[model samples]
Target: MTFRPLLALLMALSVTVTASAQSAADLGASKPRKESTLPLLPTASEADAALISAHLLTRFHYDAQPLDDAMSQKIYTLYFKLLDGEKVFFTQQDMAKFAQDKDKFGNAIWNKDLSAPFDVFNQYVLRAIDRMNYARGLLKQGFDFNTNDTYNVDRKNADWPKDQAELNDLWRKRTMNDWLRLKLAGKSDDEIRKTLDKRYAGYIDRVKQLDSEDAFQTFMTAYANSTDPHTDYLGPREAENFDIQMKLSLEGIGAVLQARDDYTQIRELVPAGPASKSGKVHVGDLVLGVGQGATGPIVDVVGWRLDDVVNLIRGKKDTTVRLEIVPADQGQDGKHEMISLVRQKVAIEEQAAKKKVIEVTDGGVTRKIGVIELPMFYSDFGARSEGDKNFKSATRDVAKLLGELKAEGVQGVVMDLRNNGGGSLYEANELTGLFIDQGPVVQVRDARGQVQVQGDDDPGMAWSGPLAVLVNRGTASASEIFSAAIQDYSRGLVIGTPTFGKGTVQTLIDLDRFASDPTTKPNYGALKMTVQEFFRINGGSTQLRGVTPDISYPNNGDEKDFGESTYDNALPWTQIAPADYKPVADMKAYLTQLDQLHDARGAKSPAWQLMLDELAQYKKLSDRTTISLNFAQRETERKQLDALQADFRARHKAIDGADSAQADADAQLDDGLNPSERSLKTELKEQADAKKAPDPQLQETAHILFDAVGLINANPKLAAEVLPYGGKQGNSASMAAVAGATPLPTQNSAGQSGGASRAPAAASSSGH
Candidate 1:
């Protein structure tokens, strides 16, 4: 089945308003005239839209349940989390007052009564303004960094303060932490004071700028997200942005951005976009400032709205946008780097699947292995609909690359899907077809309990020689589908971490279609809701559990911080009757031996050892929830981290230098090429140089595949048992027996009998 273009769901809901005649006493405020800002009130159109949205969510959503007291509590809790996730603004007393109508949120949405949510949001505005003012006041007094104290970095589960005094204490430490970060970054006391004064004032200004639309959107989104994290309500402006993104019309740095606390964080880089090609920014990096052109003044965006930050970053094609970002690996250490990228439309050619060959030497034998790196499952649906057979697609590009690799005489191929967040459900099926002759690839079950099996009807195999599919936590949806299919069919060994467990499907529904009044037709925005769930051909749903690899590798990222499993209300893993399909080959019996060979190599390889050590250091940093307030201790920690990063860079440089020398030697053999061919080779070399150092994971995978090929060639019966198209029996002098090679102790790098355990690092969200 064809799928619609996937849009990153934006939850840009906040509280704001204009002044009304209602007195502070009438509105249940403790006092009045603290600020000249007015309160926001819901409009009639918003109320009507909310009621209609509630009906659609309750009636049509996959796994929809009654919007009763239980759902109301979920909405209530989520709403507060949305408003004050750090638990700094709202006090215990405020929560107590809000709890009285906590169970009434569901009924309020159903009956078009927005007063309860509106009143709660208005109260939040007052509390937030008070805190900002308090923060500004503390900057004047300065901080004593010598104090032996600690500040909790993550307060998502922290309790609300009891009263104003308790809130003030929290803000005191918060302000001190802020000041300490700036000081450590080499800013003078005067600069710190000035910067903070502007930041806090900016926060208050942004809060005051929220209108009724913002409040309603937040409330409605809270209700939608209570059912599932993927279900979201987009306001009119957000809906328009989504359309622009889908059409690939927005000219910008091509980074998906989101608001985290007071900072705008990079969620994902659009594949082949300016940011992705720049090789500087990364997911989870926080944007601290933005500038225009090559020499524009940097504008501090610490407390700016996400939309405002996005606007500042976007520019005409060929123009440059500069970003000041704190790297994700560095946490909040206050050190940031500047990156400048030329805004450009995403190039489809850059995103197409690419092929390269690597040589693996094992047990005195050398073998050629081909690697196909697919960034995403893209297909030009518009072109295809217009009967353009030459339209680019993941499957078509991969098919051509496979033919080229076969011509290059590679013995095995690794389908690298790491960091591929999935697109084009149709491409996923067709891509799977390129592996096996023809069979069912995936199963989909709608909300009505009807299952439809999607498969390859074409009877042809592309390159069926020894195969391996590489994946990681960033692999989701269609990527998961393709990986799971290969594993289920016993066609290849899946290596790397577990796939991102995003098995559900969402479709955008324009709320304007449900409008009874013509005047409000297109003003209601849209709702992206979960309409179906994906199931594997083996009867298991790739929901919370995802797809476990045949041979697991070490992953530094924390699973809890990313993937569909991170959503508290995510759909449960389930099973259905297995689809009718035949297995091509079984690799289960060979996994133990492969794992042993991999572990032996990993223990001896310096690159592999360095990677493990780096992961350990990163995990240690990521696991910390609190940071030292003592200036001396913090400085020491920062110095140690800097040293570690320097060591890693130096080691990588050494390795790259060796690789570059070999690459240069290979380039010397291209003298006989035509002018166009030479130019293409030069272009490819430049692209390769722009990428980060060679991936240790890809090299290790090639080693494993080489071992498998040797084993198949040495043991004639093994090929018939594990090879789909019988055995290609005939061993050359180079194809030696892998079993004859002495095996090292089976202990893995982490000293476990199995593979390495998943480590803690930044998690990549789906479709970002």
Candidate 2:
């Protein structure tokens, strides 16, 4: 399939490269390090090859090109960036040696040779070992907190050190800064030294653990990213993790785990899961140690492999596991707590759509707004393929929720798509069908310039009342498509900041499934390649420019650091001819008044003000790349940050009640678990009817919807202002005239590359 070519729409996102084609010179260049005399790492074999990437990209990539020197340049730069992101390990001399073979990467990869990249990586490992040893040695020398020095935490744009002396100097300040940070955290000299020693040792061990598969995956990622940021390859172990995530079910604590610096952090709490229900463990909590059951010595999980930590946390249902957690976002001090939890199956129902009705009063009239939180655009593809009519899906659940809302006499409905990183593409179409009559929802264009319009065929409308879609930076891919379609059709008002602009679709192909050698084990892993680009019915691609809410709120994510625009290789945004359809109404006509009402209401909300203040402080810290190493200076800064945090928490407490009850309950639950079957009842009863924190964003959106209802009720014609082609052609008496932006590119949508053509999925097809 092909796609239309228009001017670049979005800013670049990011890239990476790979290694082989061994030489005597390369073998001789390998240097042993004193940090750790690890066993010789295994090398890649043909059976675990990456020939699939070259073959698939040339055959199916949206912008397929020959493996040539031009592409190799990108791979070269990307590989180095991946290996030494902070430019702390490799020196200028090291970079010069790698630069010589920059353009040869493509030819080597295409010919199944990887010696060059591997040799480069070997050098990197030695350099890293040397640096890590240097940092570790610093822990023995007591640091003087009175020294006035600063460490640049972000060195992506910094120059590579010229020699060992220059690199050593950089490491000195970095070590000092680390020492100062720990000191300010109230760590004693002995404790500080031990923690730093362990951290550096962990780094060395992690490097020693690297094998050929790990190296290949990293290089392959760089190679794939040379084309697009989304295209990627997952090794055998990574592939297993991916599958578990897609299924939204795992035999673990049900906490989203992420590697943050040197610690494994709980990124989020999955509702109904052991963690969330425990109410003891919250997001931003870091796992420092893990223990089996409620007894025995706890093993330090800090600096441990993410998968290993996950394994430690997982067990059979009713089994007990203990976690030593350090509360994050509280203070930098090394305070910690121990919590015990009984493991259970993390089922999909825990993440299903949930509904709550909130009453909002506007002009003395109370309006009940039904809110549905959609965590993901999930679907039971396995069940659906088996022809199960009762299969679970986001669309089906939401449709049922809409019906119930109607029964409850809700004046409006708010679909909360916050932090929802989209899933099923088919669900986006089906969900849009619930709000509007049959019409085109999204458009898809392939590499061959063929455009395919994906529309809703279902005529049944679940709810035709006032509606709003709430989104944030985390809402992406399928979520973007659904929201864009709703906006194009003018069926609902979108509220919140711009979303994550991910307009491309990916197709995962299991290379093992199609291997020619029957004797080969089915473990070649998988390749997720970008196959198509999606467009809204109004002819705009949500590539780099995400869906803009009709009424926006105070943004917590800065455009410079977050969203598609932050990526250096993200697909550009463009436009095509608007899809042939008529909008249900001109929702844009009420945007001005809605904005006014939103501002007026927000001015009176202490919660909104507190959120803004916190956001501002977050941005300030995020923008700083350098940190002072002086103990006094660092302590003052920490104090200021603590003040901001304390004030914010205080304001939150005043509005949302103290967390004393929740804390007490958490302590009770942690101590109550019996590590056996009898522990289940206590665990289950603790959070059976727990009340969730009120959502300020949803409440704000409800008020905005109330304003929308008030305007529409005052002038009913405004609700029937049929604007054709998303208000591009002309405006009606009820609609205002606004100049249209660039139209989406019109081209044939077919996946054609290397003189090959292939059928493409529907435009709204999701690559989840």
Query: What CA root-mean-square deviation does each model show from the true structure?
Result: 13.2, 11.5
lDDT of 1 by residue, 5-93 (tens): 11111123111111100111111211212133457788888988888788888999997878889999998988887788778888898
Candidate 2 stretches greater than 4 Å from native: 1-48, 250-346, 349-351, 660-695, 712-768
* Model 1, residue 245: C-alpha shift (Å): 5.6
- The per-candidate count of clashes, in order, stands at 6, 46
Quote the lDDT for 16 in model 2: 7
* Candidate that would win on TM-score: 2
- Tens digits of per-residue lDDT, candidate 2, 1-768, equal 111000000000000000000011111212222123333333444323566677888788987866789888988888887777778888898788788999988877777778777777677767777898999988898777787777898786899999879999899998887777667767788977877786677566667645565567667777877788777776665565555545445556667665554566675666788888888997667788877777846878665555556656766667777889987666335688999987776655656788988878866877677899988877656555676566566776787776566556676779998878777677777778776756888888888979988776644355556678999887888899989998988878899999988898777677787666768665677777788888999999999888999888878756676677777777788999988988876777877888988898889988788677767876777788898877778778777766656666567678877773343234322121112112223333444524354467888998887776667656646654423323222222112211112112111111111111112232233332
Show the lowest summed lDDT stretch of 10 residues, model 1: 16-25
Model 1 TM-score on a 0 to 1 scale: 0.73
Clashing pairs in 1: 16-210, 17-39, 17-40, 18-38, 18-39, 19-38
TM-score of each: 0.73, 0.75
